[model samples]
Target: MRPARGSPDTRSGVRWGMRLTLNIDASPLRRWHLLLIERLETISGLDLSISLPETDLPDQSGLGPLFRVEGLLHNLRSDGLFARASRAEVTVATDRPMDESDLVLDLGDGRASVPGRRWTLHVDGDAGEGALVAALLAGRMPLVELKEGGALIAAGRPGTEYGRILLATLDDVLSRVVTLIVSAVSGGRLRVPTLPPTEAEQAAAVPQAGIAQTVVKAGFSKAIELVYRSCFHAPHWRVGWRRLDGPDLFALKRHPDSGWTDLPDDGTRFYADPFPILHEGKLTLFVEDFVHATGKGIISAVEFGPDGPLGAPEPVFEQPGHLSYPFVFARDGEVWMIPESCSAGRVDLFRATAFPGGWVKEATLIEGVTASDATLVERDGLWWLFATVRDGGGSFSDALHLWSAPDFRGPWTAHPRNPVLIDIASARPAGQMVIRDGELLRPVQDCRQGYGKALGIARVTRLDGEGFAQEVETIIEAGGPLWPGRRLHSLNSAGGFEFIDGSAMVRRNPLARRKPAAVLASS
Candidate 1:
């Protein structure tokens, strides 16, 4: 049916809806610039066009020669590099004249006069080239901002590993740009959160580590890892437990003064992702039992007696793919679990027919998404699911997404604004969310140093149909008197006992170097 005279038509929005022009420098462009243009074209009610304005960018501190040699070496040795998406190549584009538009996305260095509204992009307050690279060389990702006539409209801190600085950081920054533009076109309120630390305060500029230095560092790191693996079952994790007689982590916002007791584990396998739940007046602790031999993980549970865990965690649920982060909770007189199964590309819900065992697949809450650590909570008569998604191509620990449902099981709907939070320090769920003094406190993974290097407790100030926001109040790291490890991964509490997990080193006996008799295959 044709629309009325004045009604908006999404099919023909190019004629009636807003027109957006992306202004770029006359010099060569990067792969991510084209990626941003491709994404804008997919929106329904907006028309996108390219503009090449005569401009020049600041020098990139001699990065052109450095990246050429670094990228080639990285491509040749595939195993040691950080998880990355694309190689940012400076390629040429055909010149095109600017079309009349309602909005201009100025990606150039200068803030020239434009036809309509102009939002200029800035990195760490510098609207010049090499800003991102300069920040990375100084040892951190840059804070990206969008400004209109020097007024801040939106800002975000883009994160990535230092090895693939150019490609990974660009991927995340462009991802945020899409979110900003889409919200504007859809009449949604723009999120103008407080800007993070300034570039000067964050770090001082340092020269890029030359190719020789990087090669030496990589070789030394690789050799140490090989030796560690040969001498021990490396990357082994262990859980810690203590009676919760005083304030919990949410209220305390720090590790308890009294040290935690270690949860015993056999040498064959290690346990992590501690989740303690109470059902029908019984307390049980569940973990991700990862067998070193099989190289797979399964959900396991153990009953807690008056003193401590009755025994080691026994396999309660097994799948064909790896699983972790067993987020078990009680609802509607039943116990349910949603484990991290991103390898399967879906989030599945399971109900416990028998208290801690006999878990059966109940429903698939979400599909076709590689979401990590799916955490579900009920608030204001609605169930909200939080997880970090690998949107487009970037780190899985940076882009957070949300879904809402009437119940915990079916008919889950994605939030209108996804990638609601794009911060590597506090995007991934570390454990369950808790309530303290009429406020919501969530445990999050701080992956700034490395994956699961520390834990952060954030206060959720705003969470509704409109959007989500949080303030990280505390960061708890490992290697203290209580917890001695390199990575503090997860935290949870129930039935008067609190639980946490971190990396532990377990040596393998050199005399018994042979493989185990039977490998526990996943079902």
Candidate 2:
């Protein structure tokens, strides 16, 4: 029995709901804080109010110059940029006085211990300090928590954008906090997070870059990106495949020593998000065929023989807007596909009238969501759909949301505790789920280095109506003797064939005069 929203414990006088006071620093609030307040107001049973700390918070206006310099260099817009809490635009419910029974949410740097039921934000075990900024400067996405005293209410590993580190990370952090509150109010139990432990050696512990240093770094990064784009199609991806004779990537936790055979691509386009399946007793591979000329992705398929692919992938499905991820499976004796169409603002179901062609839209699984890589699995007589949602303008690769339905197609219900996880390293679904040794294993994208920078096989500890939890057992990076690509994006296997995808540098103009390996590799 989940609570729809947060109320005091049953023993409290107000049984149905309780008053909520958001305690913040006395300094002027920033745009994000105001945005957060507005969001909370939309939820029922929150009975929201605000209280300011007695003491003024330290001024953080000094970061203004650095932000401006970095913004100009990267052409960063103000949409999601972070400034300071030193300025105010609007005021929220500061008129009301807090009652003894009111639940206090401490969102201040002072970390005042409040009476009664209280919630506080902590970053890397530091309560309400400049921990967020410290983690960002150290080039890490720190573990964040919403705690009541020493008890962990909810925790998340927020992702950051190196280009717009401050703004993006702030958005992600706030999104996680909001998720925690929503879960508590909705009668969902906020349990201790089961996220994988991080090694201390992985922490960079780098000092914050100064304004000049930030500007220089941004400029240098932009210069290299420009050169790379000029010379090749940026973010070009290629599919890799090898027959699965032994344990697959999930079991091995590393690429096979024999390595993967590259699926050749013409210079005009690239392939990614490989999904291989066996239909009609024949092996077929589907991919996101991204054409450089049109700058859009279409679902393409190719039949594979015992040795390798029979030929190049042919366009099997196309939509009004860009489509990819082509999640295909056999249901009710008919082959169906749900390709990623987040640009079209919907997750669609397609039926292949013909084996590999003649596709028709059967249904719309979900709509009005910017969700990526819709993965479906049946467990305990329920169909569960997993995808990372881009909520209120944040990174697309974080904030994992879940939906469950009795049937795979229609009438899906959003999970009450949505975004059950928010770790950049293991939130986004890389491919379909697999069961091994009576344990359910999921392939998740590790975006800590960057989007699709690596792949992780996570063991799902708990997944149900209450909440979700997973422990990442292995993180596989793309390099060394087997897979030499810079990014290991997705993983899938079927019909004794294992498939993966990764970043590849392709010449923008195939006919251009050949350049030395050193010159080409420098970009």
Candidate 3:
């Protein structure tokens, strides 16, 4: 439907959607630019048009007549500037010498000359194609296949690892861009939210001489580690636990490094994502069991007593696709589970027909999404679901999204400010959302260094139908006597027992190499 043509409504406080004319520099237009236009077409309440200049370098002085049109103007090229005295409202500005590899986008309320939001993107692919591919995929924006160097590459099909990384980088920027644009159009404040700091920013913030030496040392150390792993060592993860009481829940002190017990695992498999649940006065510990042979994970459980695990963990649930992060909870006297099913391309909810076994798929809360570590909580007479979603193809540890429903079952509505938070240091769900002293606190995975390097405790400052916000209160790292690892990912509690998981080092079995037939047959 066409938007009504008028000024913003002062009485109703609803800004009338205006016709947008894109004054783009068509000379360097690429596949990504075309994809952006396709996305813009899908947005309602905006009539869009495009105007291209005949000359390579269009005269900026002559753009005044073009700006005098009936609606708002989007000057996508920085060279074209409106006269200071002009009365038209221009909302966008692109920096000069724009290339596919680097772009600076500035956004502002149409009424202002100074832009309040700015994003600088350094494309990481060949000639900026990687960044463009990322933007197209992350937004789910479509584009026709384009030929390059005798090969046809589709918009969504990023064929290389570098391409995928580029896509993730672009996706991150695009997610923030959409947020800022939607907020501005809705007459909200033009303040930009915090996002993951760029690599350059992180480097510049550190001492250059020290950083250089550290980088060189780290590179050499990593090379040696890689060699050692290839010859004798293998990476492993193990679960750890400590008993807790009511008072311990509030002022929980870290157990001594020697006091924590390690969950047993076969040399061939590793255990992670520990979730403890108390059911009918019995405590059961659930975890993700990943086997090296299949390179996929399955859900496993072990009975936990006052001392420790009663026996070894047994398979509780297995799917054709990989599953991990067994987020289990009790509601209405029934047990429900929502494991990490990103590999299956959905957020599936399963109910136990009989205790831990006979688990059946009850419903799919979300489909066609790559979501991780879904956590749920009921508050304010509403049930809110939180998870970190991968937009197209990017880092799965950033971009937190929320959905709410009157009940845990059907008709879940997405939060208006979707992707409410996007920061690598604190966006991914790490564990169960808990209420401390009547205030809600969320456990987030801090992936700034790498996946699950630490845990962050964030307090939800504001949450409603209109918007969402949070403040990270504490960061828990993985370097103590009890739990010593390079990565600490999951945290959960039940039945006065708190569980966590972290990376561990394991030696490869020398006999495995000697018995090649046995290894192959077992696999």
Best prediction by TM-score = 2
**How does each model score on lDDT?**
0.71, 0.74, 0.58
For each of the candidates, give the backbone clash count: 0, 7, 3
Model 2, runs deviating above 4 Å? 1-17, 53-58, 79-81, 84-91, 97-101, 111-115, 160-165, 185-205, 510-523
Candidate 3 TM-score versus the reference: 0.68
Question: Which candidate leads the pack in lDDT?
Answer: 2
Q: Candidate 2: lDDT of 430? A: 97
> Per-residue alpha-carbon lDDT of model 3 for 334-424, expressed as tens digits?
9999999897788989998887767998899988788989999999899999997776644676667889989887578887656665556
Off by over 4 Å in 3: 1-3, 7-35, 47-235, 245-259, 510-523
Work out the TM-score per prediction: 0.83, 0.89, 0.68
List all candidate RMSDs to the true structure.
5.7, 3.9, 12.8
Residue 2, model 1: lDDT of 45
Candidate 1 local distance difference test against the native:
0.71
Clashes of 3: 3
